[model samples]
Target chain A: MTSLLYKDWSIIKKTRALYFSVLYFSLIMPSFQNMDFFGKSFLANSYYIFIIYLLFSYLTAYDYKYNSDNFIPAFPVTKKQIVAARYVFVALTFAACLVLQSVVRIVILVLKGQDINIMNIMDYGQAAILILVFSLYFGIVLPLYYKLGYQKLRLLMIGAAVISGTVSSVLSEVGLDMNRPLVMLFAVIISAVIYYFSFTISVNIYKNGN
Target chain B: MNKVLEVIGLEKHYDNFTLDKVSFSIEPGYIMGYIGPNGAGKTTTINAILDIIKPDKGKIMLFGKELNGNACEIKQRIGFIIGENAFYEFMNAKEMAGIISRFYKRWDWGLFNKYMREFELDPGKKIESYSRGMKVKFALACALSHHAELFILDEPTSGLDPVFRSELMEIFQQIISDGEKTILFSTHITSDLDNIADYITFIYQGRIVFSRDKDSIMTEFALVKGRKDQRDMVLGSGKIKGMLESDVGFSALTDDRNWFFRNAPGSLVIERATLEDIMVHFVRGNKKYDKLAI
Candidate 1:
C-alpha cells in the first residue's frame, strides 16, 4: 500500500500540470473572497471545486498512464489494496494542496502587511467543507471508475450530475441547509458513512472486473 | 512444482468473444511461445494469468500456488511487459525505477544499473524522449532486474527492427540460461519464436490448435507443394489440414509428412513447416480444417 501510494505521488509530482494547477489556484483564490454560492456557509470554501475537477482529470489521466489499469495488477498488490492506495493518494495530495495553498496565501497576506493569526487566514469552517467535498465526491463517483472504464467518462459525468442534483434537491426540500449547525454536523456524518461504504463498493467493482 | 505456470481449463466470457477452456503450462526453465491471430484471446489469457481480469470459471496457478490464493506473493516473483510503454512517460527512468523498486521485495539496483549501462540507456532521460527500441530495452531492464522467477511478455518484439528484436531474443535466452526462470511470450511474429521458443501454443479464434515442443511441432507438420492436378490425390490422402489452391500449385499442411513422402505422385515438393507457415495455413486456408486439433 505504501509503495502504491508512492507510485501515485510520483506520477502526479513529475507532471508539470499538478504544480501549475495548484499554483494557479493559490494565486487566484483570494480574489473569490466574496464567493459564496449555494447560500453562504453551504460552501465555506469553493476553491476545491477546481481541485475536484483536477482530481478527475488526474484520475482519468493516471488511469490512462497505467494503460487503462492494465499494468496495475503486475505489481504485488491486490485490487482492493490498489483502490485503497488511490484513496490514500487522494487524501495525501489534498493535505499537501491545503498546506501549500495556505502557506502561499499566508506569505501573500504577510507581504501585504496583514496580521498573523492562522485562524484569521483560513476559516475552520472552510477546512471542514473541504473534507466534506473530498469525502462526498469521491465516495459517490469514484466507485463508478472501478466499475466502468475511463472511456465511459460521458456516462460517468451524467450519472454524477444526476446523483448530486437529486441529493441537493432533497436536502433543500428537508430544510437541512449547511448553514444550520446541526445540519452541518449531520452532513459530515453522512459523508463519513458514505466514504466507508464507497471503499467496499470500489473494491467489489474492481475485483469483479469492468 | 514442475511447472512454473499452469492454467487449467480457463474460461472467460465476453459479449463478443469467449476464451473457451484454454489450458497450457510452462516448465520451470523454458520459453513458451503463445501464437495467435488478432482478437484470438491472447491478451485476455495473459490478463487472466496476471489476475488483471477475473475468469468466469478457471484456475491459474503461478509458481505452484493458486494465483488468487497468493497473488501478491506470486506477483512479486513474476515480471511482466504487456504493452509498448508500461511506465510513466513524463518521468525519467531514475524516478520510474525508484517507484517500481518499491513495489517488489527483491529489487536489485546494482543489477538494474548494469542493465541500464549495458543497454546504453540514459537513466536521467525521460521515457517520452526515448525511441521505441530504447523504451523496450528499458522495460526489459526493469523486468530483468527484479530477479523474477517468471516473465510474461505479450508481443514484446512486435514493432522492433530485426536488430533490436534479435538482441532481445538473446537476452531472453540469457535470462533462462541459469535454468531457474521461465518465460511465456505471445506474438504473431512467428519468425522470432522459431529461433528461441522451446514450446509453441498456437491458438486460432479462441481455441488451441496445437501446443507442443518446437522440434516436435516442426516435425509433425509439413508444407507440401505439387502441381494443381495432384490436389485431388492430396485431398483424398486425408492428411491435409489446410491447403491453398493457387494458380501454379497447391500448398497443403499435413501432419503425416511421412505418408506424403511415401505416397506422392510425380514431382511433389515437401518441406518442414515453419511456425509462420503453420499459422498462415491455419488462418488463411480452408475454414473447415483451420481448427484442426493436433
Candidate 2:
C-alpha cells in the first residue's frame, strides 16, 4: 500500500511545475480581501475540494497514460489493497489540504493583526461540508472507473463534475444550516457509509474486470 | 519433474474470440516458448495466469499451490514483463525501479543496479525519452531485479535489434542456469526460442495446437514441398495437417515425417519445419484437423 502511495507521489513529482502553479493559486486566493464574504468562502471551499479532485484526476490520468492498470495487477498486491490505497490517498489529500488551508488562514489573519479562533464553528462546518461533498462525488466516480475504464468513463466524469458542482452551489445558495453538531455527525456517517460501499464495489469490479 | 506453473482447462470468451480449454505447464530449470499468431489468445492466457483477467473456467497452480485465492502471495514469487511499456513514462528508470522494489519482499537493489549498468540505461533520463528497445530493457531490468522463481515474458524480443535480442536470450539462458528459475516466454519471433526454449506450446484461434518437448516437436513436424498433384495424395493419406496450393507447386505440413518420406514421390522435397512454418501453416491453413494428430 505504501508502495502504491509512493507510485502516486512519483507521478505527481513529474508534474512539479503544474502542481506548483496550482498550489500558488490556492495559497494566494485566500488573501484576496476585495471579494465579499460569501464569494471568499466559496472560492476557498471550492479550491479545497478542487485540490482533491485535481490530484485524483492527475493520478488516474497517469495510470491511463502509462497503462498501469495492465501492469499493476502483476505486482504482489491484492485488488483490495489497490482499492484501499486509493481510498487512503483520498483521505490523505483531504487532510493535507485542510492543514495547508488552516495554516494559510492563520498566517493571513496574523499579518492583518486579527485574532485567530482555534475553535471556530464555521471553520469546522466548512471542513465537514467539504469532506461530505468529496465523499459523495468519489462514491459515484471511483466504482464506475473500476467497472468501465477511464476512456469509457470520460463523458461520465464530466457529467459527474457538473452534477457535483451544481449540488454544492445549491447547498450554498440555500444556506442550509449545518451549524448543529448532530447534523454534521449525521452527514459524516452517511458519507462514511457511501465510501464503504464504494470501496466494496470498486474491489469487486476490479477483481472481475480486465 | 518439478512443475513451476500449471494452467488447466482455461477458458475465456469474448464476442469474437474465446480461449477454449487452454492448458499447459512449465517445469523448473527450462524455458517454455509460447508461440502464436496475432489474436491467438497469447496475451489472454498470460493475463489469466497473472490474474490480470479472470477466466470463466480454469485452474492455475503455481509452485504446487492454487492461484485463485492466493494470487497476491503467489505473485511474489513470479516476475512479469507483459506489455510494450510497463512503467510510468513520466518517471525515470531509477525512480520506477525504486517504486517497484517496494512491492516485492525479495527485491535486490544490487541486482537492479547491475542490470541498469549492463543495459546502459541512465537513471536520470525520463522513460518517455527512451526508445522502444530501451523501454523493453528497463522493463527486463526490473523484472530480473527481484529473486523471482518464475518469469513470464510476453513478446520481450519484439522491437529489439538482433544483437540485443540474442543477448537477451543469452541472459535468459543464464538466468535458468542455476536450475532454480523458469521462464514462459511468449513471442511471435519463434527464432528467438529456437536455441533457448525447452518446450514449445503453440496456440491458434484460442486453442492449443500442441504442447510437447521442443526437440520432439521439431522432429515430429516436417514441411513438404511438391507439385500440386501430390496435394490429393497427401490429403488422402490423412498425414497432412495443413497445406497450401499455388500455381507452380504446393507446400504442406505434416507431423508424420516417416509417412511423407515413404509415400512422397522422388521429386518432392521434405525439410524440417521451423516454429514459424508450423505456426503459419496451422494458422493460415484449413482447420480440417483442428487438433494436432500427433
Candidate 1 backbone collisions, by pair: none
Cα lDDT for residue B215, model 1? 87
lDDT of 1: 0.79
Give the CAPRI class of candidate 2.
Answer: medium
What's the TM-score of chain A alone for every prediction?
0.73, 0.83
- What are the TM values for chain B, all candidates? 0.96, 0.96
| Cα RMSD for predicted model 2 | 2.5
lDDT of 1 at B172: 93
True contacts kept of each: 0.75, 0.87
* Number of clashes found in candidate 1: 0
Question: Lowest-lDDT window of 10 residues in candidate 1 chain A?
Answer: A38-47
Per-residue CA lDDT of model 2 for B68-119, tens digit only, reads 9999889999989988875887777788898999999999999998988998
lDDT, model 2: 0.82
Give TM-scores for every candidate, taking all chains together and pairing residue i with residue i.
0.88, 0.93
Q: Please provide, for model 1 over B1-294, each residue's C-alpha lDDT reduced to its tens digit, 9 standing for 90 to 100.
A: 488998999998999998999998889999999998889889999988988889998799887899987999999998888877757777899998898899888999999999999999999999889998898888888888888999999899888999889999999999999998999999999899997999999887787887889988887789989998887777777788888777998898898888878888648899999898888887887675434434
